[model samples]
Target: MKIGVYSYFIKNQARIFTALVLTGILSVSSGLTLIKDARAASANLSLETSSDVSKDNTKSNRLPRPVANAVLQDLASREGISTRELKITNYNQQTWSNGCLELPQPDEACTEALVSGWRVVVSNGRENWIYHTDSNGRSLRLASANTPSNQLPTSIKNAVLQAASKRLQQPISQLTIVESQQQTWRNGCLELANPDEFCTQALVPGWRVVVSGRQQTLVYHTNQTGSVVRLNQKPNQSTLTPVTIPVSELPPPLDRDVVFRQISSGGFAGTTYETVLLRNGQLIRVRIGDANDSERSVRRVSVQQVRQFLRSLERYKFTQFRNLSYPAPGGAADYITYTLTSQKNTVQYNDISQNNLPSNLQVVVKAWNQITASAQ
Candidate 1:
């Protein structure tokens, strides 16, 4: 089925926005929890450093130059937008489907396909990340938002980025030149686009291209500095927006040592299914097969149902079990796996049996622990 432009942006924006919120929430929590104990806790809360400069504790890793440039160029041309106006809220290098950008227009044929396995970035002060095909599902866009940028609606960024990514001809590294500038001075003023320039970077006040990664020469701009300058000096916390917390960003309790005390074994077998259980995030549930079975039945359970079940089982705090099967005698057995956010819970069910258990329960527990660990 065909989707609309707004719908397309909304879908992708939701993914990026949800992650941004989660990161903010976690950063805040970390600041509150750790800053008191750590001497340079303030530095810890900052996420401004480029992902490449491993020196700072704040920045996410940088994307390869080719991919980062592609995302920038795509945002400029396809979305009829520019990087200065765009906030690198996220830079995820994960496998995403092409169907995401296929928006329904009055003319369905107008829809287009994007590269799969791309990085997704949430536009600054927006909800969704512009996606591209790269990285092990890690984001390339660096989230550096502030009060001024946050003032804009997520839809605006989505609309602009969607338009930009749709028309990308070549990656950013190949581009002859790249530039960023601020367009607006007033706080309440809306963003004005001027295609003549790469993009009008006016979301936040004192706006400038604080960080630029190019093939020939990298540049980093800052509010204190006026224009695109050399890529020197580490990105400081002052360059970023005060982090806000999203339920998704918070560390999952499942990651804690308490979550995996004793997991025997587990595997996601059979069919796979994903649903928009959360207004923001996705809930994926998989059905496991019996030991070496051909296939397992899969279904998308409600987020509410998953939450209720988890809450009910909360009394089993710190308890861990793997290969625990709730049999469906005539059908496949059900194995339970779950991920949670403040807004929703995702549950996965698979047909599983003792035989499917790994060589050691410790391994299973560790695997499960990793899932939660990554979330945290």
Candidate 2:
């Protein structure tokens, strides 16, 4: 009877241990299943949130109201200008590649892979500032005017006013001095044509006086001795006389029916990248490297956007910037060339700095850069 009882106890104890072990295994499996489900639910929620934000962005065309306000505050702080004085003239949306951050490298060719952002143009009456922001309204860059300003002596200011009044055929009282800044005379003499005995081979210190009248403004340069030397004369004086050129005599008007070809190339290698704007308003960008490698990208733009682009070109007077050149001397110096074509005409310009571009041409180039950066 004692031996039988011991055997029974041992058998029951083994069964109980097996049952506990099985239960623990089941518990661990259930816990793992719960963890997996929780992870999936979290992931789904995150995806839904991201989709909603994208939908909201797609539905909105205008910049968020807060963005403008934030930009105003930031720009005023950086430029030391009053917010009230700054006017937001233009706002544009575009894909902003991080390429510009890589200074001295030709901007990476614009591609669909780049991030989207905004470009805002602001003005403080006398100068314009370009501000770039990411989609989140964070400032990326603020390109403020870099024009230099130097105060003039009271005597020098008076002399400049007198000279400006005579040249503009306006009384001293009618003319108001808008600005006076020091300039280095690059030419040998301050005289418009004939050099005085004081003219030297070395650069001479001078003053630039801007006098404004009700109808027009006159720019004058004065030597250190306060003698008026040169006037900001109109270019191509011979062509100043208004003579009507018959349409038949003029080059055929550009083919406005459709965009033919728009190509822009720039970089250290002379042609590091090329962007082609198509008739359908799509952009095809190609990055040229060594013989073995090249990258390409395509971006689609709206018909309305393309039409507006053509309209913007209307403001450009091809004649004004024609024959003008800003030479870059060194082999590795940066250069940009724009070649635009239509059925009727093809025009091209190359320059080292857009700042040296004519006023109207500068506007055109600015618009082009903004469009290419965003669309490509």
For residues 54-90, could you state the per-residue lDDT of candidate 2 as single tens digits? 9988778677666687778876654434699888899
Query: Which pairs clash inside model 2?
Result: 110-376, 111-376, 190-229
- Judging by TM-score against the true structure, name the best candidate: 2
Prediction 2 global C-alpha lDDT: 0.59
| Candidate 1: segments with Cα more than 4 A from true spot | 1-205, 208-219, 224-230, 236-376
Candidates in order, TM-scores: namely: 0.17, 0.33
**Lowest-sum lDDT 10-residue window in model 2:** 101-110
Off by over 4 Å in 2: 57-162, 166-186, 192-196, 202-376
For candidate 1, write residues 71-190 as lDDT tens digits. Answer: 666544323344676665655445433333322211123224443454557363543444544343332332221122323223332332232333344343332212233433332122
Task: Give candidates' CA RMSD values in order.
Answer: 37.3, 20.2
